[model samples]
Target: MSKVFRSLLLITALSSVSQWAQAGNYWKATAKDGWLDGYVEATLLLNGNLDATSIDTDVDNGVVTLRGKVETDTDKALVQELVLGVDGVNGIENMLTVFSPGENEDSAIQRKLTDKKVATVVKTRLLVAPDIGSTKIDVNSSQGVVVLEGQVKNDAEKQRAVEIAKKITDVEQVVNKLTVSD
Candidate 1:
């Protein structure tokens, strides 16, 4: 997306929160008002630029959660700094794991596959229709909480992603941080 367009959308999303702040269900209204797009853009840019081995971004209800895998614990601090600058990002939770050298590769693979199973369940339930923008959706799992990030065509798809994420077994929670394109 063009930088100007993205900036404008983010601004609009943030402003919507203010417009609806007086309404009951303040946070829900804030989230529903459309700030997630800019938040995701901010997170993507931050994570993409970070030096970590792997980083995933998930934004839900204006809160951004990060799932990362790094070779060193220091990568966490560096990543936090990067994520803090994004607009409309009300909060962040770190769910990164550090793997030491000589760790059992087989066990790691098994663990990853297990996580992938959770991811697959989310994908199957949420993205069953090929017409949905599944390609844009990114799913990553760590300790069974499914993280969703992507741009959907509308609120229905966004809601669908969340519902499907909720369906994934063993997941403690579903972080549906999908942004809808205008």
Candidate 2:
């Protein structure tokens, strides 16, 4: 074969190999990386207070992070433990806080969701709500009740937020601290 024909054939072979390798990587990311989502969801769902809807999980190299809203200080503490307890979770950031509008990430909200007896009930109902999700909003629980704090777009969102928090099975009451913007 002439030199030019030989060079062209070599490039074609290499390109095919590269394409195959790229396809394999896509599958790996989908299958291998899927566990992180499941791990985070499982940990929250196990708690009566949290469900899959209110949280989002992302993993990098077996390190998992959970971001979302729960209904109390105790819930926050519980989540930190749950995420950390999972098989591969190395570092967990407790972004979930007790509901406080002015309160920074650390401020505590006094409500039942933080309370040991009823947090599960409060969290479950919130998870069921049409408006809230596993990630958006924040929940605080104290003494078996619930406190909700976060920014929503409108009054409907605010009311929906309150409604969801109140619906949890064990929630004795709901303290809606949600803020709405026009």
Q: All candidates: CA RMSD in angstroms? A: 17.6, 12.4
**The 10-residue segment with the lowest total lDDT in model 2:** 105-114
Across residues 45-149, which tens digit of lDDT does each residue of candidate 2 receive?
Answer: 776545446767777666666677655455666566556545556676556645643334343443423464344434444555456543456776665567777
Error of 2 at 125 (Å): 26
Off by over 4 Å in 1: 1-110, 130-134
Minimum summed lDDT over a 10-residue window in model 1 is located at 44-53
lDDT values for all models: 0.62, 0.62
Model 1: per-residue lDDT, tens digit, 1-182? 59999999999999898787756577675565346645444444534324543667667676667786755443454455445434455777878676642244466664565575566545544544444665678888887678889888888888877776675455787787789877
TM-scores for candidates 1 onward, in order? 0.37, 0.46
RMSD of 2: 12.4
Looking at candidate 1, what is the lDDT of residue 179?
91
